[model samples]
Target: MIQHIRISRQLIFVNKILFVFSLFGLIGAPHTHNIRAKRYFFPLFIAIDGSFTEVKVNEWKGAASNNRNQEEDGSAFIVEILKNLGADLVDSVEYGDDELTQILLSEIKDVWRRIVNNPKSLVNSGETPESLGIYMAKILFIAKDRHCESPDETFINGKCFPISTRERSEHCPENMGLYDDEKNEGFCECLELTKEKAKSELRPIYSNETGVCYRQNTQGPCENGEWFVLKNTYPRCEPVPDGCPTDGRHVFWNPDNSTAKQCWEIWTRGPCDKGQLLHLEQDSTEEPQVYCSYRLAESFFTYSALSFPPCPPGTLSNYVGQCIGCSRGCYGAFIG
Candidate 1:
């Protein structure tokens, strides 16, 4: 009888404990719960191209440059952007060995992991997902963010937006909305430049959906009363205008690098009227000319935070910003 009573008491106690645990889990256990640390693994390519083999990197930037701290600032800026855009920005930064290369690699890895990798991998499979191996098969060096200034400082070419006005954590004014950051002045200035450039010409090159044609140069007078000319192409317009068949590429692109003979396509045909984007392809590789792939036509450099696509040689496209050729082709992932 005593044994039976003891067993009953013990079972009751066990049931009570289990019930309490269930309640805690439902109500207040989160306050006491410990979160498991997320492990991030850089791809072999990023690991090898970057100066580190680990997920973390250190910048011995105690006195390297004024913008040394800005690297972290940039990372933090990115973190906020990613989070606001609903990303899994749960990892804290880790440093391997304090160096510029390490900082660049680490910061870039931090950003890329969030942007490129799916959150399901980090959540369900942890760091060693099979899909990761596909991308990490080998480390390839891409100069996506490797453009560094001389041995003195950091130079971020395409970052000219105004700084943040808010004091939120990791939030910078630069990433804040355009209307909020007092960037309207700069945007207004850009508009003025465009207006002046467009007003100088009586008839500029007009790119139809299919190909680039010109505003028709009337032989004598237009049947329509409007001042606009009918559309013309390479042979038809070449003799009429001083440089009629204007290097079709040069019509849209005003290349600043001089070496860039590519066209940057601008957006047009709307209230938006994005002019054109400049695309260039300068293959400096030793590979035979006959074996280049089609992906080579998508290299792009940022003239601003907005992206510009690049094109390979013999490919034609409109110019958007200052045009230039790169030593190699850029890899672009179109979000099809």
Candidate 2:
């Protein structure tokens, strides 16, 4: 009878413990939905040739560039790249209010594992996890942040906008606009260099949605309205106006070397425009004359792509092929 009473007491204690655990489960357990939401992977659009293609996050893990610290650094860099391409990254993800967890390497890997288990989380299911972590991070970032208005339109702030149109023959300048091809909707954006300009500092110039800056010849005005032509048509405008386009496969040269000094010498003679990017091609990999050509035209460089090394540490090869130094308080950076 005494043993029976002890067993009953023990049972009661176990029941109490179980009751406490059940209560904790009800009140303190992590939300499965929140975990799923955190695991949700987003699609990233990559412009291939002239069209944009959807890339999954797992696939991007293989392609992302590793930092000096052996961590995925390309994610943050790609974010800046997207901003330069003209979309509000923070606002697009709805994370302006919440601190973004995916930006960190731990979360990046964690989300990747979840995505591997459920391929349906990606827009493209067949993609394999390659060395595309940076690319994947960027894709996931945009996917998580992009705010869609309807099935057809994307929302920015309170307004709805269209998706990006077809890729143009030329890369758009900072003074120009770009559309969001990620949504496959129409969302053209232009740089507002004059956004903060005071009324006194501004001029009444005719601006249009195209964002093309036209230069009038002004040679006594023909039947046409002042014989204006695209600034790009001139030989002087041959160099990329908005800096070099970032393809995933760019190799940057060290500007501090002797080879770079030779390139600087060429830059000094030509008086290249500030921020112009020149591409030099070579047949033999070793000690070949690095012919300088404009980044815009994809065609193989002929005589025009001259043999020059590279600009010095403090300078950038500009549009006119001149070595332009960085302003005071600023450091020269090579974006390869």
Q: How many clashes does each candidate structure show, in the order listed? A: 40, 28
Candidate that scores best on TM-score: 2
lDDT of each: 0.25, 0.29
Off by over 4 Å in 2: 1-125, 128-144, 149-160, 167-178, 181-225, 231-336
Off by over 4 Å in 1: 1-97, 100-104, 110-237, 241-336
lDDT by residue (tens digit), candidate 1, 258-307:
55333222222211124422223222111101111132233322223123
Best by lDDT: 2
Question: For model 2, what is the alpha-carbon lDDT of residue 142?
Answer: 53
Give per-residue CA lDDT, model 2, range 1-336, as digits (tens): 865554343333322222222222321236863343234322111212322223332222323323111223212332222222222222324433233323332233334444444333332333333323334535444554334423333444465554221222123443223333332222233222121121111111112323332221221112322232123212111222122222211222334354443212222212235554443332111221222434353423222212222322222333322222232222321110
